[model samples]
Target: MNSSYANKSIAVLGAGESGEAAARLLHQEKAMVTILDTAEENKLRKKIDALGAEGIRVIADLAAEHESLHGHYDYVILSPGIDPAVPLVQHFIKRRIEMIGELELAFEMCKCPIIGITGTNGKTTTTQLVEKMLNACGVKTVASGNIGPAFSAKVNESSHLDVMTLEVSSFQLESIRRFHCQTSVWLGFAADHLDRYRSMDEYYVAKIRIFENQTEDDWAIVNYRDKLPALKAKKITFSAYVPDGDFSLREGVIHFRGERVLAMSETNLRGSHNAENLMATLGVGFVRGLSFAQMLPPLREYKPLPHRCEILRTVNGAEWVNDSKGTNPDSVEKALHSETRPVVLIAGGKDKGFEYDLLTDLVAARCRSVVVMGEMADRIEAIWKSRLPVANAGRSLEKAVELAHAAAQPGDVVLFSPGTSSFDMFKNYADRGNQFRALVQALPS
Candidate 1:
């Protein structure tokens, strides 16, 4: 047990995966820990019972206990799902109680250097790729943060890791104070999380916090396309369109510092977005003194993760592609551009306060028709009906898939790439994607 945290009172907000992991970690450190969540006690009974067995107090229905929590902690461990603007957070702020995210708390305890990856999209894919590449090159590393298990859960085993590839989200970065990454990769950025943030700038501010504590010895891998502010760390740029960066795609091959590195043909990664992800992964390997030869095995063997432009099945000549991970307009735009065949796109979900008008031109050019669904179906149809054929499937993802399949022709792609969150319908993107795969597989030949 760490003496610094011994007997320290800590409140962990939101008893989700990250919160439970944080509570466990704090308890192991001998802290007086309490887990608070807004969910009903019945819903989280199993989790509560497990934590209670470990001597950690869990208070469900946080709103009812909010008043009782005043002045009860030395610090608060905020889960990523909880908004900072919530009254409980505001109360903690008013009292000057130091609040940090699970990511930050994990960083404080992590013994290994972290390679933090953040972007509006491709975060999970890139994080997985970097972790695979590093481990293949004989570097002991693990991928965590927003991807797999929470960073706090992995901190206990950090001593065994040479480094960690963390998928950092803007939400996790919001409350970070001293969190720093040895190699920070800002893959790319676009408007997202508008519902949680006041404006795009506010969201960008949170995302760029990955570089807040970097020193000269550290590295920042960024896209040349994104205009970033001055940073303390040495910056390495990568791009799929431009050839001027330290790493870039020129012709069909990827070049590093004007030298040939790897050909795009050698890897299974598709799309310009993935090209950027590959380059960023290479940049991390470069910083770690890994040779292109050493990284090629993992890079060559890597395949796209499910739900991100994953081709599910073919009915006649039409391909059913699941891009359910495409949760924002930018991601949908990329999915559209990646397809060579005309797409019958199934889009729309819970609106995140973004305008679908931005995708109008792209949709008109790349899609044969559009099928909208979930809460934003009407709004998406309203935005695209004038420019192209649009059908509203309301709240049924199955209906959206049927509509898309009906609209698809031979040699065309039936793309299910919802441009908003999955909360309005299914449990999450994976659930949405899994159901999509099942639905598409069930379609009559």
Candidate 2:
């Protein structure tokens, strides 16, 4: 695989990180490479210049028409963000051009042992935790894929690393025909990605294909609490309650197969949702032959990721938590259950066809006030307006925070767990969370 396509002509679709990096990698491999993007030529002129200097052709705007681009290239490397239904991409498919994801291209180039992590949630947290645990065990590894650098570029450059830890998204996994991994884990499932996939079954099947390419000799880890994962893998279950094959938090102590691993420690990550994330990380560590002693110590100092129930500051005795990563009803439900105190919930964004009815009941039971924002603010406000005091602050997050803070009592919690995406008001979840943090900090001390 490494040496077979050295001189083959390769066309890269999109000019984002994955596409650009893949084009660079393919060029470096001495493959005739060209990048085609829908981005304006004026906008990507400098990037095109850089690629031109690297001996790769760059076509932008209408100049990147599929017919002209696909006529000459042998293979097409797709950016994960592009929908296959797009006419240009569909044309390539019809022409029978060999299309693969950046991950698949990376797999061909990567020589190290791969450990891929996938789930509905907790992928980013679990990926980082796994990297830290392996590093503590004296293993040289870097976490990449959906969480970090483009996997193709990482494989092209990394020389001395012992392992590659990847957070594989369903979109990236969709085109992977033979992306193999030693250890793969499915955390849990719920309604998600209704916009990209035709049905939930299609979405889940894409995720499970991570294990579909593995052999019997390969290792697969799963959570016992999750029904789909056990059915998909040769199971090794971790729990928050009783001990099983590997790690469990029993009676306030962290243990692996009944051996005490770590004691109760100061980790800012609260709630049972995070507890499940910890269990999944520990399960991966145990499968890789890391000792319970070796794994637990590094994790003791581990910090919870920002925007996932991250505690911002104590404002007038009220605790504000940023959970901008909670982009669906299931995540919001978990965020609400994480605390016992009444919540002033800030939620609303671009709808991805997810139902908000479940959220209304959760808010009634746990939330004191619902502060709605973004484009779908009216829709969210309508659902909970009858049952609770709902405030509509339009599309501004700052105004939403101010309203939530005003509605929150001293002992209550103000949470930003928007049960939808940020595309309506911001670039992405990270940007949305950053703005929320900035607003929170600007409030009175």
Top-lDDT structure, candidate number:
1
What candidate 2 gets wrong by more than 4 Å, as runs, is: 1-3, 63-67, 157-159, 229-233, 241-246, 250-253, 258-260
Residue 110: error of model 1 in Å? 1.3
lDDT of 1 by residue, 1-445 (tens): 2227889999998889999999999999999999887788899999888889989999887773466577478888899989989886777777888788899899888998999999999999999999899988899999998996999989878899999889999999998888999999999999888989999999999999999999999999999999999999998899887778898887778888989988878888777888889999999998889989899889989998999899889997999999999999999988887788899999989889989898999999999999999889888888899999998899898788878887889999999999888998889999999999999999988
TM-scores of the candidates are 0.97, 0.93
Structure candidate 1, residue pairs in collision? none
Report every candidate's CA lDDT.
Answer: 0.89, 0.82
Residues 298-318, model 2: lDDT tens digits = 777788788899999989989
Cα RMSD, each candidate:
1.7, 2.2
* lDDT against true structure, model 2: 0.82
Stretches of candidate 1 above 4 Å error? 1-3, 64-67
